[model samples]
Target chain A: MKASDGQLIGYEKEGSELWLWDDLPELHMEAGYRIDRLLHYERSPYQEISVAETAAFGRMLVLDGVPQVTEKDGYIYNEMITHLAMVTHPHPRHVAMIGGGDCGPAREAAKYTEVERIDVVEIDARVSEVCRLWLNRDPSERADSLTHLHHADGAKWIRKPPVPIDVLLIDRSDPYGPSAALYTKAFYKSVYDSLSADGITVFQSGSPFFDMKGLRITTQRLRSLFPVVRTYWTAIPSFPGGMWSFTLASKGTDPLLGCMDRLPTDTRYVNKAIIPAAFELPNFIQSALD
Target chain B: MKASDGQLIGYEKEGSELWLWDDLPELHMEAGYRIDRLLHYERSPYQEISVAETAAFGRMLVLDGVPQVTEKDGYIYNEMITHLAMVTHPHPRHVAMIGGGDCGPAREAAKYTEVERIDVVEIDARVSEVCRLWLNRDPSERADSLTHLHHADGAKWIRKPPVPIDVLLIDRSDPYGPSAALYTKAFYKSVYDSLSADGITVFQSGSPFFDMKGLRITTQRLRSLFPVVRTYWTAIPSFPGGMWSFTLASKGTDPLLGCMDRLPTDTRYVNKAIIPAAFELPNFIQSALD
Candidate 1:
């Protein structure tokens, strides 16, 4: 029996869905999605990347055994990760995205009327090609206007001038691999130097439950460089902690002071209500970040 | 290979971790916890009752095969479900609790210095005793000061009077079988008539993702009776939806106008930051309730 056959809905075989991350043995944890099939799997020069067409979440891009983005919930991540900082900075024109290989952040930033240029610096060009060819669907139905794909090391590349970015979106992978440099204070200083005087940078902070040290260290690193720093979260069921934290580091403008009563572009999730609301942390998580 | 040999942790065999609900098989989903052991299993006059001691979640009370409460994250649900309404009311003295046989709501309500008494009306007495003898560890360290458990049907019992309750916590099971009447429009009217002039009531609304129909009906029912009704959500990773919703209905005062700066007692999760944040729903969910 299968769900497609409409035979009372719950008759699919267990082995039909086979994407589970059994990597985190310490917490006795694993999480993955129910996909239609594995679409593309290959080793890029940087990392192992796999794309899938999920049954519930549409297309998904998995890198190194963890899900980077899924079509269904990508808007929640991409919109909040981009718009939270973009809207906070008074006039964010030239936005820089570090390690957004999937082009999700690029597509979102391009939606904003205020954003003139978006430089998405992904280490692996193959991830962007895979997404462009397979996973990139017009989720919000916005015209992909101005997102320049740059294949280079983001840590060193952002040091050079590129229009003095007003807002930077760090959509990097976790802090354990080649992406580790992006989490350092020096890297944050480099990002600070690349931004305008009133610039803001947003990035996905690690889950506090499973990656408390990473979250603590990341927040500390950002706080040392930026004047105003805060942590917010979003929920995607297939993730390890179910709650994913995002940090906004600004020079003077605070994202919590997000009062752009109306967005310049359309979004599925991010709104004025969600801006300050997202910063509310659970007590345990608040303690972990402390 | 085990976590229990003179160790601070407890470990059990992989076989001990079972009972994934294959009932909702169409989504190809299941969720279960690693158990220390199945402590109790039997059928009450109403429905099935089973208890288990879990590795990650401490003791779990699963009624009719759905988890009622888990020790690890029970306080998160217990506190949010109780305090959100309790704090909103001007002076919550006499409170009412329905269907919380695990005494989670009663325990949390007893923490309030302003709450002199709480009348807990539950149909099943056996469920209360089972938890009292086994699972009620007082995670919040509040003395069992003023929660009186009444063994009576809540739907009919709440229709009667108990000094005109100030705050009501309806911690019923899912909106099905025995617990279905509590979600009806008429039952909501009964609750409305039972409350004080400035009273507020709160209940666990169904998940918008899996049980949208129930969420819709619950919100509709609450809206028809109360002047103000709002839906808020919390995340308990082990639950069915990973996200759970609660509805707060007030006679004239709005729960959304919550501005209680502090609490009278200690808590691990709920704080002033979480109140307004919890009420901020995602766009799709806000549309569902609309």
Candidate 2:
């Protein structure tokens, strides 16, 4: 079936075997995954959410026809996104997440004993509830005490954060439809104001291979508001373009000079050796940013 | 349609539009590319070869229904496979490439004035012919003088090299079928014997995310054969799993201590900063290797 955006978005069912077809019409590419079973499906107030048991990736969380995270490889994305900012800050007592409804980032941030509080502002509450029941099944993995779940618009929540945050992680969806406001200058200004003097804001920029223009614009906008801006990348197999980028904008601290020794040793992806190495962008990416 | 292996391997035609589907049944994933036109198709003595004009990736080369190289992002794979070994050796005068029929690696190696000779031994001559005619069309981009294309079996040719090579690059397909012999200890022994005293050999060692066991075995075999063995990775979007790993085995020279000042300045993906950075494996990959 064709989606409202004229892209193919449906499962090609063959008896009990199912294949989820994710078509990226803009990039003229498509990825298909074999589904073992459908766990849950719902149309939240904000978007469509679904959960499925995949043959290779175990359980997967799909948001509006896009695969967001999977059980097997979720550690790579969650650890990369959360730990990069967590270790970069000298003392990140309070952390605020913009739109990580899956609680993957919250779980990772909670691993750091230095973190005292984690405020997650997600517009869709169903996403959090569903993912918790399906993806995050381990009781020991839950960050219950330090995490405060707020079902409010991230843009509005950031305008007046309850406390100054040392690390602001923008974990929203793509910059489109309802999420477009989060990519604007006004939203970025609010993020800047909600942070401490030595705060750092890290967000997932689009794919370096497919979304060079979007990455360039995001970096430029962040550079306009922050003193130090850097871009790094990691590979997420579930993403359309396996290569994904993240941008870091800091007010005063240099990310490269971060305390690498403070990095959590239990992470699956990030390590003390890779913290500085991640910042070394390839020639094409650096040339694009320049 | 399904291939003989029961894997889906055909282009889904929608009116005039076609999407070439490359299915990795083992990984339970499929990737599709929109084809502008089919340029060529043939059955070689070794495998099936086809060329297509793709909407997102320009010209694409597919071997046995597997996407090998695309003109747009081919530079990343070619440069990474060529330069990492080229710059590591102090003075590499002669290089031997095992199975790069597309001539991408040869073109990259030819950029250096120091590289006097290149010997490319490919089992199938038709692959070289088709790629040269369709994928590599530029006359100036051709490495005509330095590269010697030998239409012969690479595993056999490496056993008795014409001369002592300073760098040996194994650019073959996955370790299967006709190429399976290239991954054995006998083949690696020949490669070690064919190089100079301080020679370095680099080969693509499968995807880290999809083929961890293969990577671990390959690293183990290389470590047994060479004094220094290291595995590094770069992102290739067209490849399944996106993240690709390459293993380097050197006789005496350490890859990390190589002369970074000698890296070619005109390459698109590799640069001085990324040369060392690429070697820093994430914790998961490191743990797997350990």
lDDT of 2 by residue, B1-290 (tens): 22223333466675667778888889888888998887887778878788888998999998887888998889899988989888889898898899878888898888777888889988899998998899886443337788899999899998888889899999978888668888888887888888888889998898998889999988998888899999999889888878889999999888899998888788889999898999999887999999
TM, every model: 0.85, 0.95
How many clashing residue pairs, candidate 2? 0
In model 2, which regions exceed 4 Å deviation? A1-9, A138-142, B1-9, B137-142
Scored against the native two-chain complex, candidate 2 gets a DockQ of 0.79
Which tens-of-lDDT digit does each residue in A1-290 have in candidate 2?
22323333456675556777777889888888898887887778878788878887889988877888899888888888888888788899998898878888888888888888999988889988998899986544337888999999899999889899999999878888557879888888899899999999998898999889999988998998899999989888777758889999888778888888888777889888887888899888999999
Error of 1 at A200 (Å): 1.6
Fnat per candidate: 0.33, 0.81
Worst 10 residues of 2 chain B by lDDT: B1-10
For residues A170-283, write the lDDT of model 1, one tens digit per residue: 887777676988877778889889989898888788666557777888788888888999998877555554667888899988886765763643677777787778888988
List model 1 lDDT by residue over B1-290, tens digit each: 22233121222234435422313344444443455566776677877677777655678887766667887778788888998997888888998888878888877777777778888777878888788877887643443557677888888998886689999888888667678878777788899899999999998886665576878888888888888999998776666536678899998678767656635447788888788889999887887777
lDDT of each: 0.74, 0.85
